[model samples]
Target: MSPLVQPRLINGPYDDPGLILDFRHARRAILFDLGDNHALSARELTRVSHVFVSHAHMDHFGGFDRLLRLSLHRDGPLSLSGPPGFIERVEHRIRSYTWNLLDERSADCVLAVAEFDGTALIRAARFPARRAFAREDATPPDLRPGLVHDEAALFIASAALDHGIPSLAFRLQERMRVNVHRDGLAALGLPVGPWLNVAKAAVREGAADDTPIVIGEASIPLGRIREHALAVGPGQSVAYVVDALGSPANEAAILDLARNADQIFIEAAFLDEDRDIAAARRHLTAGQAGRLARRAGVRRMTPLHHSPRYLDRPDALRLEAEAAFGSEP
Candidate 1:
C-alpha cells in the first residue's frame, strides 16, 4: 500500500538536521527544520507551505533566509511554527531586509508565523512579503495541548525538550491511509485522475459511504468503490527530535509525544564514552537516543546529529545506540 507521507532526511547524521515530509499524492509538503537545506532543490523548497522549527538556534534556523527567498513568489501564504519568541524572531528577520523596491510590484507572498510556548500558541503574526514584511498581530485558534498545526491530510504535534532552552520535538501523523486498487481500476476500464485524491480526502473527512464520486460522465457511490477498489488502514507517523538533553522530564515528554510512532529520527550527539560531555552540553548520547526510542515503542529509529568529534568513527555511535535498543550492531 502507498504511504500517506514520504519522509526523507535533508542532510546526513553528521550534518545539520532537517526532514522534508512530502505528501504522497499532493503538491504540498511540510518542512521539519530550516537547518542547512541547501541540498533541497528549488522545486522541493517551493512545495513547503508549512515549516516547523525546533528552535531558533543558528544551525536549526540558518536556512530561513534561503526559504524566504525561494518562496517569495509562491501562490499561497507560507506558515512558520516554532517555540516561544518565534514571532519576534520572524519579524526581526524580515525587518533586516529593505523592501522599497517591492513597492512597485504586486505583493505575491504572505507569511503566517506562530509561536508556541510548550503546546500553547502564545502569539501569532502575518505579513505580506511586499510590505517590508510588516507584522500584524493575528488572533490564533483556541490552544490545544500538543497540537501544533492541523490540516485535512494530517496534523503536527510537538513536545518541549531541553537544549539549555526550549527546543521542540515534532510528530506528523496522517488521518488515514487510503490505497487505490490499480488492478481494479484497470479491470473496470476507469482511468485514474484527481477524483482518486478526492476519494481519499472524503474518507479522511469521515464522509458517508453513500457519498457520490464523479467519474467521467457517471456518478458512482463511494461504497461501491470501496467494495471493489480500495483498501484503508491506519496512516503513517514520523517523529523528529534533536539537540535535546537526556533529562527525566524531557525523556518522559518525548516518549509521550512519540509513543508508537512508525519511525523516529532522533539525535545521537555523542557516544556513551562521552556521556558527561553530552549531558553538560544538553545533547543526547547514542545510547540515550536508542533508550528513548525503545521506551517510546517506536517501530524504527534512526540516530542522527553526531558530534564532529566522532567524524572518523561515526559507526560507533550507531553501534552504541543499537546495543542500547537491545539489537546487535
Candidate 2:
C-alpha cells in the first residue's frame, strides 16, 4: 500500500538539517525545519502548507526568506509552529525586509504562526504581506502537551528537549491506514475515480455504516464498501529530532516521541571519540544517537547534522552509528 507521508531530507549531513513530509493522499506538504531549503523546487516549495520550527538558530531558520518569497503569490495560508518566542522571531525576520511594493491588490501572503510553550500553545498571530506583515493576534489552539497539529488522517506531536534552550522534536502519528481491495472493487463493478477518496474519508471519519456513498449513478452503503473494498490496518509514523542534548531527560523524551516510528531523522553531530565535545556543545555523538534509536525501536534511522571536525572520516561517524544500532539496547 502507498504510505500517506513521504519524508525527505532537505540537506545532507554536512549541511543544515531539515525534513520535508510530502503527503501522498493530500496535495499539500509539511516542513520539519526552515533550514537551507534551496534543495526544493519552487513548485514543491509552494506546495508546503505547514512548517514546524525546532528553534530560531540561523541554520534552522535562515531559509524563511526563500519560503516566504515562494509562497507570496500562493493563495493558501502558511502555518508554522515552534517553541516559545517563535511569533516574535518570525515578525522580526519579516520586519527586517522592506515591503514597499506590496499592496492590497497583491496575492495574500498569509502566515499563521503559533508558539508552543513546551506544553500548550501560549501565543499566535497572523501576518499578511499586504499589511507589511504586521502581527495580528490570533486565537491559540488549546492543544495538549506534545500535540500541535491535528487532522483527519494524522496528528503531529512534539516534545521539547534541552539544548541550552528548548529544541522541539516532532512525530507524525497517522490515525489509520486504509488500503483499497482491487478485487473487491472490480467485483462491485466500481470504476476507479474520486469516489474512492470519499470512501476513504468515510472510513477515516468513522461515518455510519449505513451512510450512502454516491457513485456515478448508484448510491451504495458505506458498510458494503468497507467490508468488501477497504482493508484497514495500522498507520505509519515519522519522527524528526535534532540539536537535542544527550542528557537523561532528553533521552527519555526523544525515545518516547520517536518510539516505534517507521522513520526517524536524528542528528549524529559528532563521533563517539569526540563525545566530550558533543557533551560540551549539547549535541549527540553518533554512537549515542544510534543507541537512542535502537532503544526507541524505530524501524529506520537516518543520521544527519554531522560535525565538520570529522570531515576527513565521513564514513566513520555513520559506521559507528550503524554498529551501535546493532548493539544490545
Q: Which number leads on TM-score? A: 2
Model 2 poorest 10 in a row by lDDT: 320-329
Give the per-residue lDDT of model 2 (tens digit) for 264-292. Answer: 88899998888889999989999999999
lDDT of 1 by residue, 1-329 (tens): 67777999999988999999987778878999899998999889999989999999988999999999887777569999999988888888888987777742754788999987776777888987767677788976564687898877678888889999999999998778888898977876778998988877887777888999898798888887776778888888999999998999999999998999999999999988898999999999999999999999998898888899998986988888878877657
Q: Please, what is the whole-model Cα lDDT of each candidate in the order they appear?
A: 0.87, 0.89
Clashes of each: 0, 0
RMSD values for the candidates in order, in angstroms, are 2.1, 2.2
Model 2 scores a TM of 0.94
Candidate 1 lDDT (Cα, whole model)?
A: 0.87
